[model samples]
Target: MTSALAELSEALANVELTVPAAPARFLRLEFLEDAPEEAAAADVWSVTLDVSGLDAVPAAGDTVGLLCPNAADEVAAALDLLGAESRADRPCRLSLLPGTTKKAARVPPHLPEHASLRHLLTHCVDLRAVPKKPLLQALRDDAPLVMVAAGTGLAPLAGFLEERRARGQRAPAWLVFGCRHPELDFLLRDELEAALRDGFLSRLDTVFSRTGDRQRYVQHVLAEEQARLARWLVDEGAVMYVCGDAKGMAVAVLDEVVQTVAKAKEVPVSEAKKLVQQMQKDGQYRLDVWS
Candidate 1:
């Protein structure tokens, strides 16, 4: 007799596949700003885009695809716009996530009109929903939320915090943000400080890597707060969110988390790794990273 796998393969041998629909075109509104947040890093800036005509706006911590011609050193700058929202002026606000460079080129303050930008609106391609790479389902749970971010990684987390504040949801939240210098490189400093003062954020930790005697990244700061972090994870049932460059910062912070958890729980490294894996599987440890 034929095997079950062979029977299933034969049953679908002639099946036809369906193609997914294309994205809807959104109208580009206007450029708001591309001001530099840090004097030390001249190329790093906060960029904004105004958009309209979407069936639905993405929630906080969501991403939107953007195709801007001649914006970068490359042929075109196709970027993922973070912190998307619909504003009151019949326009949607697109806040470019922090630490973005177009082929290492500086972002101009103005967003020039391009052929593709015009065609997008004329063609009516939908960009309402962007695929989610990180799971933020923990926000819905009762567990405390701890956010770790560096450079542009803070953008989406900012949006998430704002949404939570707007909804009057005061779930405990801790933010650990790292930059080159606090005076010259801190992104959204005013907003973050206000959140802390107003009680939206339970804890706020900022790390400046360049000012210290030794170059200390966010992972170093995490190590210093290992006790608090471990307690949050093991006792409080906290959800950890990490966002940043995948090449170094994110990897380092993840290592710190596992090590701290192991020490806190008095377990072997392998067992600690299993705990991390389980957290990831259960959607408690979320990551949104890019190169």
Candidate 2:
């Protein structure tokens, strides 16, 4: 039986399998028993197999196939040897066994060309990890800062603000977050309100594009508070951080900032642009952009 087990092990080792999704299942199964139910039913006969080699990457919602039935039998035999009870009439279905793949969470498709900018912006600010680093770094700089974020882009900004508050670093911070509707689309209203209540954030200006008579955005809010924003920029050496869709929101915010600086400081547009460029060179102006 030991010799047979050794042969089975060798055979199983050489077997190949393909999974249809990301290989998180194989990674997770490393610490789990091959037959958890059997292991629980008979502790003495329990077996745990380390089948990490079967890991494979596949697209979400794809199917996989195991080419070798003999290898599966050997694996089952190994589990059975550990006292895993099996019904001889209905052996475990190989196809039904957990695959080495995993399906990623479903995400909406990218906005179509004909979609409204508001719709595109709404879906652009995914709260995923790819854009968190820059946002967090900007928050940690401990200087007067203006954050402009539109649509779901507020997600990472919210995370950055929360992290700064958690670290007890309450440097004067301002947020200008724009969305389609304050009532229907506010992403982090509670958190922003709590920060305001606790004095973590100095000011929050919300612009709702579809609210009231005229459409408004973060850029509009910045324009409305040009004097205050200019004071923060020129007097306090405030940093500016913008996060959101890269297509229109970023460009529009930058243009609005330039215009606001020129109008408020009574300087030429070129001078305002140069001043913003200098701020960027000095690490006072940072952008975390994503499509």
Highest lDDT against the true fold, candidate: 1
* Per-residue C-alpha lDDT of model 2 across residues 9-107, encoded as one tens digit per residue: 999999997868765654333564233322222111213434467565322112222222234445445446645434333322222225535465333
Task: Check candidate 1 and list the clashing pairs.
Answer: 23-125, 23-126, 24-125, 24-126, 25-124, 25-125, 25-126, 38-184, 98-152
Model 1 misplacement above 4 A: 1-39, 48-52, 68-132, 135-138
TM-score, one value per model: 0.63, 0.53
List per-candidate RMSD values in Å.
20.9, 26.6
Error of 1 at 70 (Å): 9.9
Error of 2 at 183 (Å): 2.3
Cα lDDT over the full model 2:
0.67
Clash count (model 2, backbone only)? 3
Candidate 1 lDDT tens digits, 1-291: 469889889889978989999899886877645433454564566776665666666577666555433323221222223221221123333345587764755433344333343233323233333454653432773558899999988988998778878877678899999988877768999999988888778899998877756778889888999999988888898888999888899899889988988998899989998999999888888889877
C-alpha lDDT (0 to 100) for residue 234 of candidate 2: 76
